[model samples]
Target: MPLEKIKVIAFDADDTLWVNETFFRKAEEEFCALLEEYLPKEEANKLLFDVEMQNLPLYGYGIKPFTLSLIEAAIKISNGNMTIDLVQRLIEKGKAMLQEPIELIDGIDETLRRLSEKYRLVMATKGDLLDQERKLINSGLENYFHHIEIVSDKTEKQYKKLVKHLDITENEFLMVGNSLKSDILPVLNIGAHAFHIPFHTTWAHEMIDDKIDHPNFRSFAKASELLQIL
Candidate 1:
């Protein structure tokens, strides 16, 4: 599990590479405010999250799915009395979110540029394929990645498959990202090195209470600090 053995370094997109969850948070706030007449903001937020979890299996993740969840939650909150105009507003919100300017995480560009020189860098993330690809291209960091792996979800099986696809053994793979649930745990479970660079805010679904203690696990506060070790 030594860093010396790592030949491929896979990075999680979204908050790890650029600003992502922040937009989602803002959207959720706006969603709750939009439904305040039907439900309290707190209750509306909770209901929206529940709706999202329930829809995950069917819709997966992305702005489109989230937009759908917002509309569905609005219907339920209003007991199916929500206005069509409100629905249209929610759709517009999602479209606006999809078009939000890409904000790169501090120092990620330089970090990735430097890492690419010595490692086979891959952008391994889970979400809507088109949206993720679009973000990558717009972030202007696409050239640093040797491969892009966009899965529906990040799991141990997917990480194993990724390692296999890269023609590397598990120990030769290292994953760096911001979420413990999606990025760290699964990679470590697959016997690969996993490093955590936590974002300021994470979606509730991706949050975990477990304090990770593993030979292959390490956590850092920022992207630039990664250079100190790897």
Candidate 2:
């Protein structure tokens, strides 16, 4: 049976709605290549990613402070050569991240517009509060969503909270995201429906080492095509 009976449709804001992770991955690569002479490729990226992983507890998720982590790694390894030039470059990159608004995935808005008329639309995104809010406010789709939840993590806790607030059952709602670990599994664990759309660029931290081949999880190739499954 298709997920046609779902009354509430919740969407993941990051890669599901638009392009994300790719910019950061490119930044990380460029940043690492700059230091690749001093550090092994694996060692360089691992160090940068480690610094970022630790900063998550303090800064949460966003491109602003993630750029800072890269700067920190560069400075720490610069051997007293950390100049104003490097810092200035990092600052420019961070500003670019902040100013460049949402890049919607193909057919995302059109599909959402169609779905909004039939089902309750909610933004189920997880990231830094201010950054996520800025993206939403600029995306021009803010008016379409009835509610938005930005959290540190996308566990069952957040999903349960949404169900409680909306007065809906787990079975009546559908969770859609690019991340299987954070977005698809937990909701499916609770018996809610899920749609998984793999991203073109995936962050190392957000990746799942294991693959999923399950009955309840529906994987779609394009955003517009999601309407068919629904």
lDDT of 2 by residue, 41-145 (tens): 678888888998888889778887788897888876676477788788877887787777688888988999998988999999888788888888888888778
Which regions of candidate 1 are displaced past 4 Å? none
Residue-pair clashes per candidate: 0, 0
Kindly list the per-residue Cα lDDT of model 1 for residues 1-230, writing each as its tens digit.
47899999999999999999999999999999989998999999999999999999999999999999999999999999998999999999999999999999999999999999999999999999999999999999999999999999998899999999999999999999999999999888889999999999999999999899999999999999999988
lDDT of each: 0.95, 0.83
Clashing pairs for model 2 are none
Write down the TM-score of every candidate: 0.99, 0.92
Model 1's TM-score against the true structure? 0.99
